[model samples]
Target: MPAQLVWFRRDLRVRDHPALVAAAEAGEVLPAFVLDPALERAGDARTAAMLTALEALHRATDGALVVRRGKPEEVIPALVAEAGAEAVHVSGETTPFGRARDRRVERSLDVPLVATGTPYAVSPGRVRKGDGGPFRVFTPFSRAWLEHGWRAPAELPSQHRWVRRVEGEAIPDAPEVEANLAWSAEEPALERWHEFLDGPIDDYDASRDRPDLDGTSRMSIALKLGAVHPRTLLADLDRVAPKRSKAAQRSLKRYQTELAWREFYADVVFHHPRSAWHDFTDALARIPYDEPGASFVAWQEGRTGFPMVDAGMRQLRAEGWMHNRVRMLAASFLTKDLHVWWGHGAQHFLDRLADGDIASNNHGWQWTAGTGTDASPYFRVFNPVLQGQRFDPTGDYVRRWVPELRHLEGKRVHEPWKADDGYAHDYPERILDHAAERQEALDRYEAAKG
Candidate 1:
């Protein structure tokens, strides 16, 4: 059989991999990964997790996985020539950079560069309005996404052969990361998914908003790296829903919607690539923003004096991940309270987050900053104290991450300023008053609109 080169990017695992299945059916497959400088700008935690995942993939390929360091455009074609590959197969790319790089590689390749699937359950640009145009808002897009369901997970090839003629570099060592990274490889990610589906998924709807509990699936990095596909998760949800309780069913549905939000953001980026870095809309296009200075440093250091914001920031640096609810609250504090640009916060997140993706992280910041696809736009500022009290009611979440506030008991942790001994533990004073900053944020929004 002719040899084919399967260039793995975001999609790393072999199971439910459309490109891998297609390549296997066509010919003997050579699995290759390129350590492009462009894609290696992740923080220590993300880089460490990714390298670990690649090692797992290497073992899965029966020690035939090719790891090369260079631009994919140069590396892939060279591999094709060396292996005598008939064609190069890959899961399609959606992000602006990925799409452009793929196009360049396609143009440079001597043979066909066939694309079979994407990192998303539904590839960006697939779901559209009844009129065939892109959906501007999320609610409509999510409705259409559910209506336009995806295919069943792809089956593994019955019999496949590996092309091991070519040799490549060894996977490089990872930088030192302070936070703990749990199971990151394909098998481990799958194990975590099944565990969530069996138990925690039942209370996901109720507990997802709480930061104190391990209520989330923790599958963001898995999905981002394509250690597991969303299609597989969706299929499993369908299989287990009937056997589970109504609460589980509701939780499963909510989980599915969260996945939809990911896809929706990708679609928005596909349609408007500039939105990845700039404001999606003109809501805050000309808003006066303060430079990220001392206050910004305080926010990053988790010393913002707001226990909830401090806790979220501390959690981010410690774990390379933060609770989703806290992410929104932290973002709101930065943009609204400190008047810093959302991009600064987004960049910091991408640097530290193991599961960071441009579409989701940047757009999420934009959403909180009232500059993205949010329907209400600016003026909706989060009250850190209230948000902390509501979500982390017992203040356990704040106490867990913020050691200084651990001395404060119960809800007192959320509002240390109110307690006579609030600063007894040496926690920093509130950087700025939320009520005063809230009015300032609104005033800036009005000026920008005018």
Candidate 2:
């Protein structure tokens, strides 16, 4: 039987994989991954994580997973010819770059390039409004998404025959990163999902916002890399939690909505590809943005003196991941308090985040900056000090990443300047007065609108 080439992209796993199953059913399968130079633009943390996952996948496939380096349009055709594959199967890519890349590869291949599924629960453009046009806002989109439900997770192939005739390059070494990745493989991802389902998901609604607590599922990187599918998570949620209790049901629903938010952003990008970098709406089109300067450096280095903002930035530096709530606070501090362009902050995040996804990261930044779909009002400037005290109440979250402020116990850690020994350890002073900047940001918004 001729081999079917399975080209793994974001959808990396063997389980619940439509492309993999389709390839396996066709005949002997040759799994291949390409290390495209263009896609390596993400920072060291994402690079390291992707490499680690690729290594794990190699082992799982019993060393039959072929690793190659080059442009996919060229590399995939060569692999198909070498393997004598009939067709190349893949999980359909939704991003603008991905779609364009696929078209190039398809044009290059002699055999068919069949795309079976995508990295989404319901593929980006599947859930549309009654009029058949895309929904601009999230609430309506999410409602339509639920009404147009996703299929159950695809079943794993009953058997496998991996082709090893083709010679391939060794998986490259991962770049060094400070954050410790607990797990990057398919098995560990499933384990984490089950663990979250066992208990913590019940409190996700109320506790997800508290950065001081270990309250999040932290499956973002896994999802981003396709270590686990959203459908698998959704299936598990239905099987275990919804019937546990009323409160558990609410948490389950909240978690589901959060997942939907991911899909919603992807949908937005699918419809308006330019919005990936440009503002999704024109409300902030005229808003003047300051150039990144000394204050920008302090914000990035976690010395902004707004404990929550500093802690969030430092956490991102050390761990390559920041709490979701803190991510917004940090972004707000950069865009609003520093009066810098959201693009600058968004690019920094994409560079640092292990789970940096283009659609989600950029859109989330725009949302916080009040320039994207369903954005917060322009005047809703987040006060970093108050946000810290409110979300990081005990201030342990701030102390965790900002060691210099550890001396200030309890909530005082959030407002170190008020504490007697706040700057005794040489913690940097506030870069700019928050109240002054808040008004300045507002003025700029009004001026831009006028």
Candidate 3:
């Protein structure tokens, strides 16, 4: 029997998968995964998370998720020759590395490499403006996106006729990275999603900003690994919206906007591949960035002495994730206060985050640095102290992450230096005065404009 070869990458799950379905449409299906040594040897937090998720894929496919390590160019064609696959099938990749790998694989394969779907809900490059160009700003792009809606999720394949006796390397264990694995696999991922959808989703709008509270859906890692599909989530949202109270409906709408932002960044990277390594807006590129010196180390180690920035950094170290609001404050402190380049902060985040998506992580740093599309105002700096006070009103987030300030009471924990009983608990002093750095940042922006 002629077998269909399914080359799995980010889209790990079987249900709601177009590529898997397309591949299975042939006589028999051979599931395969390649460990690109270039990606695996990075030995970062994300690498471990991906391995954990791949384990779930192993179980899902009943040991048929073929694991091989090498250049995809060599491994894939060799697998095809051995399995005698009629065609190599995949959900096409969107990132620069992914695109390059796909091209090379297509060239080497004797049979056609059929691309049925992509990792994105609406594939990047599919939704563009009335003109042929991609949308730079988000609001118009979102409206167009709604108009250019994606198809319903593809049904899972009915049967699995595993073509046995295939020789490939064992699925390797996750690397022994210093960071702990946060989101393990699709099973736990689904539990978290269903829990969030059932209970806390109604409060997502009002409470997503508070780092201390579990107000937001912890689905990013799941989304990153394709443990669950965005279309599946969207369909659930539609099913529940009518039954929800008006307030809950508003909250769900707000949460939907957040998902759309993810797609927007993906689209942004798809059209402007250069933005991955360079500044999206050139106007601010002339500003000189400070060297990653002692101050940079302080920021990385959660010793910045600004409770909000420190707390977020500590949380990242502990959980391999940080709250969305806290991540912004942390990124802002790095770019605007420390005068370090956004790339430095972005790289550090990619090294740590379990949900470290290239498009979202890099563009998020750029957005905060005011160097990317729809940039935050260049002169606007996040006062880490005030951000802590405003978002984490009770100082719970600060105390939770920065245990050094646990002795302080209530929101006063946000400004430890100002406390009457100011406990000088071994926490480092604020690296640079916020006022001083804010002015310094503005001056550089002025110089860049001039």
User: TM-scores for all candidates?
Assistant: 0.98, 0.99, 0.97
- In model 2, which regions exceed 4 Å deviation? none
How does candidate 3 fare on TM-score?
Answer: 0.97
Q: Among these predicted structures, which one has the highest TM-score? A: 2
How many clashes in each structure?
A: 0, 0, 0
Q: Runs in model 1 with CA error above 4 Å?
A: none
Model 3, 257-348: lDDT tens digits are: 89889999999999999999789989696899998999898888899888889999988987888899989999999998999999999989
Query: For model 2, how many clashes?
Result: 0
lDDT of each: 0.91, 0.90, 0.86
Clashing pairs in 2: none
lDDT of 1: 0.91
Against the true structure, candidate 1 reaches a TM-score of 0.98
User: What value does the lDDT take at residue 183 in candidate 1?
Assistant: 56
TM-score, candidate 2, is 0.99
**Candidate 1, 237: how far from true, in Å?**
0.8
Question: Which scores greater on TM-score, model 2 or model 3?
Answer: 2
